[model samples]
Every structure is written in structure tokens, then in C-alpha cells.
Target: MKILITNDDGIYSPGIAALAKIAAAFGEVRIVAPDVEQSSMGHAITHSRPLSLKKSPIAFDGKEAYRVNGTPADCVALGLHIYPDTEVVLSGINMGPNLGNSMWHSGTLAAAKQAVLLGITGIALSTPVGKTEPDFNAFADYVKEALEVIFENKKLGLYNVNFPPQPKGLRWTRQSVRLYDGKVVPALDPMARKHYWITVTPLEQAEEGTDRWAVEHDFVSITPLRLDLTNEDELKKQLDSAVELNKQL
Candidate 1:
């Protein structure tokens, strides 16, 4: 199995390095990631500008690695083009949590989504960060276990995985249909110039089997996701309403 590993965090980040080590045990691992952090960049591609891919010799335990000057999705796109026979695409070991609706804007998850769009199974792994530094070596075994399970079920399409700061076990979860309290705060710099900062505070509510609920309860949450966003019930309702309107006319 040829595996392509990537992350929203830069190629130099400890998170990617840790992920690469785990991936190396599986197959021929290729690490192609953003040269700089592209966190919360969504499922964006690099169609506007030419992408720059610089090969780094002996990077990530001597696995073939490259640094890309683009978003996480861009890295996956180029990685696939270069290594077309790649079986799996693994993104992150991200610096933060990508749970609930936050997955919509997470570059970590975006890389994985890109792979699925290209007709490959994609698995995105992330861990929450806090005041205490994460001991990745301690959780390496757990990550390997998670990857093995994902690999065993390759036809599952795209998956969004988020590990707790202190993970106890894994759970099959669903995406939370919850909203965050978003705000834009204006601040003044030293020069007294005003600038705005956009922020979102998550309202962590546990509803049994949701991704946020599992993560909040100290479990590794795995949510199988799909590219289709159709509202079948709504579509059926609208079709019925149209028929009624046509009869009236």
C-alpha cells in the first residue's frame, strides 16, 4: 500500500513528524505538506497560483517527503499527481481539535476530503491541544491502531477522526449538527489602528454518539463522512408542493 501523508500544520511541525512515523510502518509513505501552517483553510485548492513542491531528502525517518507552498488540499492534489498509485491519504495529527461543524473549515480534514474526491479512501487524524504539551510518543500505539482499522475498511470513503487530549478508547461517531457562538472583536494596535479578529467559541454539548460528545468524553471519535450534501426529505416535500400548485393552476 502506498500511503500519502499530509497536514494543515507545516511540514516542520512535530504533529506531521509523529504521523509520518506511524504511517511508515504500513507501507511506502510519502509526506507532502504545506511549507507553512494552513489551519482552518477549508477544502480549498491552489488554482490561482502555481504550487511549489520542494523535495526534502531524508525527511521523516528517511521516508520520501516534500514541502508544498499551498493549502493542505493542494498538497494532497499534487501528492496524488506525483504518486498516482497511492492507496490511502492520511492527513494530520493536527495541532487542535476538528470536531462537529468545525470540520467544515478544517484544513486537516480538507486534505483527506481531496483524496476521496480523487476516488481514494481518506482518513484524517487529529488530537486536541491544551496547556500541557502533548506526548505524541505515548499515543503513537493508539494512532497506529486507529490507522489499521481504517485501512482494513478502505471502501468507507472519507473519515473525520479527532482524539481527545487524554484518549481512553475509540468510538464510531456522527457529526454534530450544532452551531458555535461566533463573534468578531475589534481591537486597537499599538499605533491605535483598529483591526477585527474573528473568533468562535464551541458550545460542547454531548448527544450520545456525536463526534464532539465522544471527544469530550475522552474517546477517539471517528465519523464517516460523504461528499453529497443533498436534503432528500426536503426535495421530496418540494416535489409534492409543486404537484399541489400545478393542480390548483
Candidate 2:
């Protein structure tokens, strides 16, 4: 299997390197990622300017790695264009966990989403970070195990996988749906200029059997995702109500 690997944490991030090394065990791996960090960029594509891809300054063992001057989504778009035969696109081993509601704007997930959009299997992998960077070596085995299980499902086109620092096992999970408390914390920069940091705090705890819950309990969480965003139940309800109103009228 030909695999194209990309991430939002830039080309030099260790996360992508670690992922490339493990992914090689599965098939041929190539890396194309942003030259600099583009975290939280979502599925953005550059329209105003032409993007560029250059050989990466850092090496990923002997894998063919390149850096792009674009978003994570852009990298995948270009990578697939370059390696048209790529069978799978793996994004991340991100520096931070992309779980629950955070997936909406996660560039790590966006890279994988781009692959699926182009009719290829896309998988996004991530893990939590601490005061220091995560020890990817410790969870290398789990990463391999998760990929093995995910590959068995040929119909699952897109997936989001999160691993704990130490995983006891793997669990197929659903995305956590919960409210969040958004806040903007005011602060002063080194230049004494006013600044604000927009952030969110979860309102409730993780529910059982969700991606968030699985990772919190030290299990690798694999959540299969789809491209459609339609709420079929709501659409059906509106259609039924409209039909009833027309009959009365």
C-alpha cells in the first residue's frame, strides 16, 4: 500500500517523523506538510496565492519528505496530486489531542479529511501533550496496533484516532457531543500591548463510549467519520410538517 503522510505541526515536528517511521511498516510512506506550524487552521485552502512544496530540511529516516507553504488541507491536496497512486493518507501524531468538538477546526483532522474528499482512505492520529513534548516511543506499539485494526475496515473512509500516554487497549468510539463555555482571556504581551486569547472549557464531563471518554481512560480511541453533515431526522421532521401544513391549507 502506498501511504502519504502529512500533519499540521509542520515538517520539522517529531510527531510526523515518529508517524512516518511506524507507517513505513504498513507500506510506502511519503511526507508532505506545512513548513511551519498551522494548528487549528481547519480545512482551509489557499486561493489567493499559489502554494509551493520544497524538500524538508529535516529528514525522516530515509522517507521522501517535503514541506509546503500551505495549510494541512493544502498539503494533502498537493501530495495526492504528486503521488496519485497513494492508497492511504495519514495525518498527525499531532502535538495535541483532537477529540470531541475540537475536530471542527482541527488542521490535523483537516489533512485527513482532504484525503477522504479525494476518494482515498484518510486517518488522523493524535495524542495529548504535557509540559514537555509527548514520548512517542512509548506509544509506538499502540499506534501500530490501531492502524492494523483500522485497515481491516475497508468501508471506513475517514477516521480520527487518539492515543493516551499509555494505552491499555483500543476502542471503537463515537464523537463526544457536549456544550462548551467559550471565553476570551485578556492579557498583556511583552510589548505591553493588549491582547486576548480565545479559549473554551467543556461544560460537562466525557460520556461513556465516546472518543473523549475512551482516551481519558487510557484507551486508544478510533472514531470513524463521514463527510455528510445533514441532520436527516430534522430534515424529515420539517418535510413532514410542511406536508401537513399544505394539506390544511
Candidate 3:
């Protein structure tokens, strides 16, 4: 199987390197990632500037790799559009955890979402933050186990996997039911220019059976994320209600 690996954490990050190394054991692996960190870029694509693809000698266990001057979504777009032979797309092993409502803003998950849009299976992996550098060994093991499960089941959907600072075990999870408390911090540049930085503050509370809760409990959270956003059931119900209201009118 041809596996295309990409991440929002740039091509040189150890997270992606570790992911590439582990993925290589499964099949032919290729890396095409952002030239620089594109972390919270979400599913953004570069349209204003021309994208550049450069050959990178940076190898993860001697696998072929390339660097792209674009967002994580752009990397996946370029990979599938240019290399149609790619069977699976693996995003991340990201430095920070992507959980709860944050997944909507994560470039790591965006890459996987892009792959799913292109009809290829995708997997996104991430590790929680810590005061010091994160240990990639355990996360790599989790990735390996996830790969085994995916390969064996074949029906396992695209996943958004988030590992805690030091996960104890893996748990199939659902997206968090809670919302993020996002804020903007005002600051000034050295030149005395005013600016604001968007910051995410964790909520003081968490609901059970959520991705955030799973990670907090030291479980490697694996949430199946689908590309389709249509709420068919809700739409149908609304339409039925509208029809009844029209008759009453």
C-alpha cells in the first residue's frame, strides 16, 4: 500500500518523523508536508500565493520526502492531485493534542479531512502538551497499534487520534460534547504596534464519554471523523415540521 504522510508541524518536526518511521513498516511511505508550521490553520488552502514543492533530503528511516509551502490541507491536496496512486494518507503525530471543539481549528485534522474528501482513508495523530518536550515513543506505539487495527478491520473509518502527555492505553472515543472557551489576548509589538493573539483556554468542566475526557483519563483517544457534514436526519425532521406548519398556516 502506498501511504502518504503529512503534518501541520512542518517537515522537520520529530513528530512527523516518528510517524513516518512507524508507517514505513506497513507499506511504501512518502512524506509531503508543510515547509513551516501551519498549526491551527484548519482546512485552509492557499489560493492567493502560488504553492512551491521542493524535494527534501530529510528522511524518516530513508523514506522519500518532500516539503510544500502551504497549509496541511494543501499538502494533502497536492499529494493526492499529483500522486493519484497514494492509497492512504496519514496526518500528524502532531506535537499538541487535537481534541474536543479544537478539532475544527486543527490543521492536523484538516489534512485528514482533505484526504477523506479525495476518497482516500486518513488518520490523524497528536500528543498532548507538557512542560517539557513530549515523548514520541509511546505515541509511536499507539500509531503502530492503530495501524494494525485499521489494516485488519478494513471497515475502521478515518480517525482523529489524540494521545495524552503519556497515555496509558487506547480508547475508541467520540468527539467532545463540550465547547472551548476561546479568547483573544491583546499585545503590542516591539515597534509599539497593537495586536491580539487568539488563545484557547480549557473549560473548567468536561462531560463524560468525550474525547477530552478520554485523553484526560490517560487514554489514547481515537475518534472516527467523517467528511460528510450533512445532518440528514435533522434536515428531514425540519422539513417535515415545515410542511406541517405550512398546512396549519
lDDT of each: 0.89, 0.95, 0.86
Model 1: lDDT equals 0.89
| Deviating ranges (above 4 Å) for candidate 3 | 246-249
- In model 3, pairs of residues that clash are none
Best by TM-score: 2
Tens-digit per-residue lDDT, 141-193, candidate 3: 77788777766756535888888866688788889856567899999999999
List model 2 lDDT by residue over 1-249, tens digit each.
Answer: 899999999998999999999999999999999999999999999999999899988978888988999999999999999999999999999999999999999999999999999999999999999999999999999999999998998774999999999999999999998999999999999999999999988899999999999999999999999999999999999999999999999
- lDDT for model 3: 0.86
TM-score of 2: 0.98
Tens digit of lDDT per residue, candidate 1, span 1-249? Answer: 899999998898888889888888898989999999999999988787798899864367778899999999999999999999999999988989898888889999999999999988999999888887577887788888888777788474899888876789989999997868898999999999999999888765758999989988988898999999899999999999999999999
Q: Which stretches of candidate 2 lie over 4 Å from their true place?
A: none
